[model samples]
Target: MTHTTASTTAFAPITRAACIGGGVIGGGWIARFLLAGIDVKVFDPHPDAQRIVGEVLANAERAYGLLTSVPLPPRGRLTFCATLEEAVRDAEWVQESVPERLDLKQRVLGEIDATCPAQALIGSSTSGLLPSELQTTLTHPERLFVAHPYNPVYLLPLVEIVGGRATAPATIARAKAVLDAIGMKGVVIAREIEAFVGDRLLEALWREALWLIKDDICDVETLDDVIRYSFGLRWAQMGLFQTYRIAGGEAGMRHFLAQFGPCLQWPWTKLTDVVDLDDALVEKIGAQSDEQAAGLSIRELERIRDENLVGILQALKTGHGDRGWGAGKLLGDFEARLAAQVAPAPALDITAPLELVETRVSPAWVDYNGHMTEHRYLQVFGDTTDALLRLIGVDIAYVQAGHSYYTVETHLRHLDEGKLGEELRSTCQIIAVDDKRLHVFYRLFAGPERREIATAEQMMLHVDTKAGRASPSPEPVMARLRPIALAHARLEPPAGAGGIPARRKETAAA
Candidate 1:
């Protein structure tokens, strides 16, 4: 049950992880670790555990492949072991995602403590069980703590780290470091509290939601819509407090508290009361949820959800139309890390057009016509031009030196539609280049068949950005570009190159 991958960091210990349970959460942990280039050993005794893990991995790969433009490390190996001992034998970290029975959890925690290496950290993925209780039976309990993650653990960045009295401070610090390396935000709770912070707030909301359903105030769908279509969007970036502060006008939080804080005392919410999960109430909720799903399979619903999430998160990356303020900041930071790690494309065909950029049509790229929108085509062309500029030693440093290429004109022609998830590549051929001007033609091809989706002819002028006018290209840049232009000159000229104003063909000898 051991195989290696192509990409891995030299950071020892954290390179390998053991997941003791392979259900949804455990499989998610496996996927996350694997995607981060950490080899994973998983132990799950369920008969269909492998199948389930495979399915989760597929879904995770689909979602995450579109989640960020970050260049992820090559996927790590996934090994399913027969027992927990085999899984954690040489592992540096152990994540236990077993069911939420206290007795079972205690026994398993003790077993892991006895079996795993003494220095290895043990993280229990318990939603509500206190870390104190879980670590009680451990002989070396200092390494045992809670590292609870949200559902779809691979996509969501938050992990709640709660250390019990027996847990050492260094253990929490190391855990946070490992989690951060894997692109997760580990929020360290100061004390061991039942349910921790996120789950406590989530449980309160759940309780109120159930009470509303029980009282026939709203069905499941309506309640969900109310959150998602309104407050849920707000909560993604600004939490309840900040959102309310904005609602208070320019006066801010103090004014907000004065204006609406008294509403908390009113019977506006059912938080004070509890709802009985009787058969009738349960049936009503279940039936409504089922109806809301409209016979879509769980996998189908999951895909739909992942698509919507990816779209929103990617849009936030651009902060399009000034939306996605706070969440956009996180996306931008993640992309910066990705950009730092990404290696430049290697040298390829010198005698032909260089294929500079490749990307898939994301969910956001789609328009009402069921294909990529017009503006997105321009974005791809712009990105293609940027890629070529980078290849020719024109980058941040070059621009900072007050010299850069500014596109003055572009002629674009759309040929075919690009559907969602279609892989697209842009190829650029140098049409002409001089000291202060460069002209290139680009073709966008998409899908496995490589159908030409669009074409663009661009005219760029070298500019001294500080001077705000056209300028001669730097010698270093010309050194790089001249060879590429020479090599590309041998290829057949691209069709539709440099056509701007329409030219009428002469009628044959009328």
Candidate 2:
């Protein structure tokens, strides 16, 4: 697979997608696409498709929250269909994850060809199946190609796109656009080839790994450790050729290749012969895997794997700049921060009240006016209230210990429209704090101009997070909040100074 120069042209947004299988891989594909804000429809014949897919989605969401630096766009709607035809009927992209059998792929491709629109792209998730073989029976074979992604597709960033003879260059370009928008790195294969790039590399390593295990050179855990602690680190930043080039110390690729070429003929690997998947071998591998991953559930193992991948990828991204594969880095680059201007008084500490939490206006928050929508104003204000609550000892830890706060009601007056790229700052004032409920007023300001954007008045009731009941604010937290709230309360309220105030409707005349 070869990496193409980054293209400036953007493809049409992928609003709707379809998945042909609801197994692990298919479910992961669904989660990734949906979390990137594309609506998805899934088709699978299994009886527990919904339950299984839902579980996978839940795990994917958790992983996404931890791995991604930026908050994900609103999740797309997910639908389960009874048939493959129904699933792809309205989809812009059809992700085929049916079993690895060629006959089954041929059948599914034929069905997709008959049902989906001519312009839609069909992406096969087959690890090694040639695109030509998969599209042999389809009427529009050019629309079908391999978009092979690694297992646990949600975490891995690499997606190899291989085009068959009939596949159009435009189709590959469009597929690359879709992958790029969803924050995945895509490499195009110049021509369709067996096993693609990553798999071929893995196959070479696998042959050697098998030889080691067969000859009792090392156990599974030790072998994994050797790679994780050494080559894995180097590979994260540079590929095989580049790594060796550096090792040659200014001699470059030519010298490295000359030195390593002699080792190719040595009996270092058993790639020429097929390995048997006999019962004994299977049992041995399974037992070794169990021993290696002892006491860890699948979810725990997956989290560890994803975290490691994120850390390594993020480091590479930071070190290499925008050399592609910089999704998290790009997000971090786009982040803007707003800090409170006011300082703490000599007698009191203001750090608790003014600590900033970073958040972005999600695409879903934009209204028809192409600006941050109205309801979102109230939502951000609510978040401000939560921040205040936390400062005043009404935080999650407090709530979980049988104390919490609920928003009784809110009144919002939007003064100005906030659009994309507009940075928002918020300040909260405690109008009143008592035994049962607290009254707070919030001011939302826009950017460096400090223009008033909106104002919100909210009433909150303390409650128990565990018992689902109301309680008083903790005494210590209340003591800390009292001074700040009282100080703000004494200041005069600004009049129509932010942007504009909400207007009231007039009564009908008699």
Output the number of the lDDT-best candidate. 1
Summed backbone clashes in each candidate are: 0, 4
Alpha carbon lDDT of each predicted model: 0.80, 0.70
What's model 2's TM-score?
0.65
After superposition on all C-alphas, the RMSD of every candidate to the true structure, in Å, is: 6.6, 16.6
1-510 per-residue lDDT for model 2 (tens digits): 000111112222688999999888888899878876689999999999999788778767655544543323446899999888889998899999989999998998899889997789999999899999988898998888899987678767578999988888889999998886676667898877789888988998897787677667887899999998999777766767778889877888788788888998898668886677678767776788899999899878876776676676566555654443344454333221101111122232342224222344444356688888776676667656655664555544465467677887777788888765456677665556676667666777776687778887766777766767777666787677667766665566544332222223211110
Among all windows of ten consecutive residues in candidate 2, which has the lowest summed lDDT? 1-10
- Clashing residue pairs in candidate 2 are 399-403, 403-464, 404-463, 452-498
What candidate 1 gets wrong by more than 4 Å, as runs, is 1-14, 69-71, 89-93, 110-121, 137-140, 267-272, 320-324, 345-390, 394-432, 435-473, 490-510
Residue 347, candidate 2: Cα error in Å is 40
* Candidate 2 wrong stretches, greater than 4 Å: 1-12, 320-510
